[model samples]
Target: MQIGNWKSTPELGPLYRQIREMGLERNIAELDAFGFTVLEPGVAAPMEWVRRLRDRLLDVAHERTGVPHDLEGGAHGQLNTQPHFKHQYILYYLLLEDPIFQQAVCNPHLLALQTYMLGFNCRLSSCTSFVKWRDEEGYGPTLGLHADTPVAHPIPVGKDTHTGNSAFLLTDYTLANGALAMVPGSHRHARQPGRGEGVDAAIPIEAPMGSLVVWNGNMWHGAFPRSEEGLRLVLTMYFNRAYLYPQEDYRRNVTQAILDANPKRLAVLLGLADANMWDSADGPDFRGAFDVLRAAQEEAGLPTTANPYEAQPDETDVQVAAG
Candidate 1:
């Protein structure tokens, strides 16, 4: 790991302490001991939901790549072997086409993990994928080990890494599969891996479909080549503090109906609070989102000071209903 300028504590307030009291000490210990932790498939994601997300991704990938690829094909025909390729279609955002992605961002365990690691004000950075097809030997270049951010979002080197990626495996991961490789406790190194360095120490992760792996964004990690026949598909939803910019402008993709339905974690994940986009002037019939958001926030036990975005008097008629 390349040494860096890392702080000893991240900027988190009262809400941070509250999250500690939520009794996540065991999981926190796992994160401290290892750069990442895996949740058993049944506990993290149900098979029904897993199949839905996998089918959705494959449908979109097939349409765009014009390949007759199923979920097993991984990236269809858009696989990019270049390390850190900014234009990699596999990493593109997918929240707009389906509400399943909206639900995914608010996955219960995922939300709880972020609140403890990044505070309740964390927002979704990117909901993307890492895919490797059998034709390519299920191996892609390492993205180069680096913390999710240059400064680790002001999180201390030992306590928390500020940003996290909760990766859901859409298929099997084994020693022979294109498994993710990681250097345990590398997040505490407070640095980035020099190009092509640290690959030797990485251990292949073996897990089954529907299982999820949550990791500190700073972990020294990358992909390992597969000697197996099938592809490896992983859906990753990355998050960081609300003040940090999100990779995707999620608000634009969230529908008004979704806001009105008020999934407890949606507003924060969608970045509505950061943008001050909490209301509608479309009158009482349009179903404004602010009141709905307040209800959702209260139910989720998120702090009011952190969100509960207010609208100017004329901007909404929903305030009366909210009160």
Candidate 2:
């Protein structure tokens, strides 16, 4: 999609308008220059808020894996323990289980970055935690340096990279902790990197805790081996252009209570609503999504108008929080 502004409708509500404009121009510049950018700690949320999110995720990791854990020792988790997962343990559908998760994924600045990179009608394809355990028994740190989108739509010979991700560090991302390693500007590489080329040439991303690292999914990137003594946790929300189907049906996973309680701006991100999503909108029973949007008005009961996934401009003072 061309880099431009998307208009907002009443159904988008006031919050969407504000997020639509947050740090837009600067973020676009960063994305164009390097295919990624790092928003400082607290840009997406307060330090205390993110700290709590980390604790909750760790709690879930231990419970789910039956692994004894402590911050000092880190928790044990991997594909063997989680048979259906890859890399580290994946905690899916966290959006419905906890309020803090909802707050993290729908963070205003994060939303703005997603819009600027993936387009206005972007779909939050995945909300998962890639937990790197330090000293987990038999755990290996190395992973392939690869692109998330190369499988579905191989990067055209001369096209800009597509698909993107927002990885919020609950703990600091540093070389000592197996931070994400990448070759700057590698997203524009002619094609996928040879196995050893990308991995050998990559550099670790060292940023403070709470930093939100945004990157094109096609970038040559992977995690560094964990050498630290604690957990290296990051919550990543991967986004795709509006047209592509999400890996998990976010719409079906959430409950009526969550829908009624959440802000309307998240309705689209959560797949509770979308302006142009017609994959399931063929019949009069525009499915449960349309009905959810209709019922997603402000608490005062004003009729929600228009379900367009587009965003509009504003002057909300998008702060990067100075990493």
lDDT on C-alpha atoms for all candidate structures: 0.67, 0.66
RMSD for each of the candidates: 8.3, 9.6
Q: Compose the digit string of candidate 1's lDDT tens values, residues 85-177.
A: 322337477766677877777777777777667766578888887656553333345534456754633346455665788888888888667
Model 1 — TM-score against the truth? 0.75
lDDT of 2 by residue, 1-323 (tens): 23333354342334344444464556656766776788888776889998998888877777766775565676466535343433356666566658888887777687766765665446778888776665332123334576666344346635454577878898877787878887778878736676566655778889998898988767777777777686778788888776677766777667767756666656666665553444454532333455555554443143454543223323223232453
Error of 2 at 302 (Å): 17
TM-score, one value per model: 0.75, 0.75
Lowest lDDT sum, 10 consecutive residues, model 2, at 309-318
Clashing pairs in 2: 6-311
Error of 2 at 242 (Å): 1.4
